[model samples]
Target: MSTPYRFPDYQVAGDADTTVFLLHGAYGSKDYFREEIQTLVRAGLRVVAWDAPGYGISPLPPEGLSIERLAETAACLIDREGSKTNIVLGHSMGGIITPAVYAARPDKVHGIVISATAGSFSQKSAQDQETFLAERVEPLRAGNTFRDTAGAVIDSMFAPTSRGPMVDLVREVALSTPADTFCAAITAITRYQGEPNMRNVKVPALLLAGEFDQVGRPQSMQSVQQQFMPHADFVCLPDAAHYAFAEQHALFNEQVLRFIRERVLAQA
Candidate 1:
């Protein structure tokens, strides 16, 4: 279990009927959702995004366990927030956690948004990822700096078309994460297995992937999407890579909010 994680910086939008819960990817802090939080708040929906244990301000887990524990931790936080219905969104590794939240407490989350992530980890790829995480430690210890380290990984996370402040912000935020914690998160993701459970999710879902994503590539996402609620909508952001949310913020935000309004909030 994770230590109690606080999201003191999350701004509540004063809206009475809707809440938006966002989870960032591995190597990301709560700050990853800064724009989404603000956008949802401004759109009159209460926003709640948190830094999971071992990332951002939250304490790291003792064993550096898998993303399953992180997903459970997030669901606990959502339960504590006192709303039984809200929109739950996750990106990348965070995307892997989204379904866990619903499975843990289906009553609390009315919808889900999974960006640039898949439910399964292929055996061969998982092994390769384990190797990469194990190997990156020396460079990280050699004063390789999160900024430079993050730069190396950025090419795999976003589309070539991604540019502007959001791109820079993603890099900075990725670098801000403690290197060990980042690696540990990756290790956990590699061993994770929860997508099969997503097949039972009853909430409305919006699945989006970038056309050129290299990390949580689009093809894997498509395979995962087929396991989602049959009624769930899936879309591809053109000219985008893995970080489609940052690559196309305006469009991403619009599609997300509109989906929530139509599928979750409107029914409520």
Candidate 2:
């Protein structure tokens, strides 16, 4: 039987019909979606943000760690919320969970927004992450700050222009996360193989990429679109990095809201 877990949770704004579920990236919490939540709520949409298992307020799962487990946890959360029609938005690692959620509960999600995140990482990225975490996780568990040890993760996650805010926010989240939980999440990512069938996704998907997001390269995102979601909408946010929403809030919100408005919200 699947275990029940409670993650750090927060509400932004709304009622039954117009609801949105927001998932943050690794080493992140519900706070990651604060700005997006506020904006969406102001526009009369109900929004929800939750920390994934092993991150933020949520308890880590047993020994086994995988994105599929996290997705199951999210599905449970959605069932609890009783949202009738909802758009799901995910950022970075959060993006990995979106498809799983869809796979678990296809009837629940009305649309999806994947920002600055790929369906999966390349072999080179896998090797790099393994090398980077070889010894750092132990130091983190021994009370060394993740901000000090995970600098490379921070550096690679943002573009030069967006580094300032990205650094600050990630540092805050990293410092707050338990060292062991961080290790588990990284392990999950290393082993995760995300959805291979972008075309199999029947729901309307909004693929928003940052012009300079190194983690999820534009080419890889485009490849996913061309190969799988040929009909899916694509938007590139100029002057943005991996954390595109933080770097270009206004444009990000505009593009996202427009997509939701034109596609999902209108149907309701």
Candidate 3:
């Protein structure tokens, strides 16, 4: 049986027929979308961004968090909100869970936006996964300060021309996240495989990429779009890094609003 968790909710903004739920990546929380939420509301979207269990003020999952559990938790949250239809936008690690959300509750999500993330981690070999955890995760559990990990993650993600405040916001959120949460999330992320779930997504999807994203390359994102969501529109923001929504806020907002307007809202 699938376990259900009542994770703490963070309302970013909006009050319209459609709810746009933003899911943040590892080292991030609801605050990660702080910049883009208002713009989305202005565009007539009912926006929702939450601190997933184990992040921010939210309590850790009772049974320890996993991607499947996180996805189901989001579905339950959406069900409780009672929106007839909703749009989900996920970044980085959140992207992995977003597809699972669609697969688990296709009835709830009208559309999805995948930003700076891939569909799966099963692409890597077991040795590579182990190496990833050792290099990225072990140190956290081994007592690397939150600031240490946060700085490394933030520095690698933002482009040279990225926003100062947005970068700072992410760094702040990353510093606040508990070390345990970071470790567990990375562990779960390394083992996840979303390719199968990607195949099951019935909703329209918009794949957004950053031209200078080192973590999730534009080409990889484009490949994901071609393979999983062939019909989905792929938009890449030049001069933007991993956090394109923050680096190029206006363009990102315009593109997302247009997609939700012309594609999702028009169809859903």
What lDDT does candidate 2 reach at residue 102?
Answer: 76
lDDT of 2 by residue, 1-268 (tens): 2454555455546654668889887767776666677788888788888877776656776784677777777877777774668777888777877877777778888888888777765422666456546644766767767767677666566667775554576557645666667787767776777755345678888888889876666766777778777777888888877778877888999998898889877766
Clashing pairs in 1: 54-59
Which one wins on lDDT? 3
Off by over 4 Å in 2: 1-12, 122-144, 163-167
Model 1 TM-score is 0.87
Q: How are the candidates ranked when ordered by TM-score, highest leading?
A: 3, 1, 2
Candidate 3 or 1, higher lDDT: 3
Q: Alpha-carbon error at 177 in model 3, in Å?
A: 1.5
Count steric clashes of candidate 2: 1
lDDT per residue (tens digit) for residues 1-268 in model 3: 2576676667747677888988898877888678788788887778888889888788876566788888988888787673766988999888889999888788889999998876677744467456556667767777777677567757777888776787677767766777778778886787677888887788888888899886667887888887877888899998898888888888888888888889997886
Tell me the TM-score of model 2. 0.86
For candidate 1, what is the total of clashing residue pairs? 1
lDDT of each: 0.74, 0.73, 0.80
**Could you arrange the candidates by lDDT from highest to lowest?**
3, 1, 2
lDDT for model 1 comes to 0.74
Clashing pairs in model 3? none
How well does candidate 3 score on lDDT at residue 146?
69
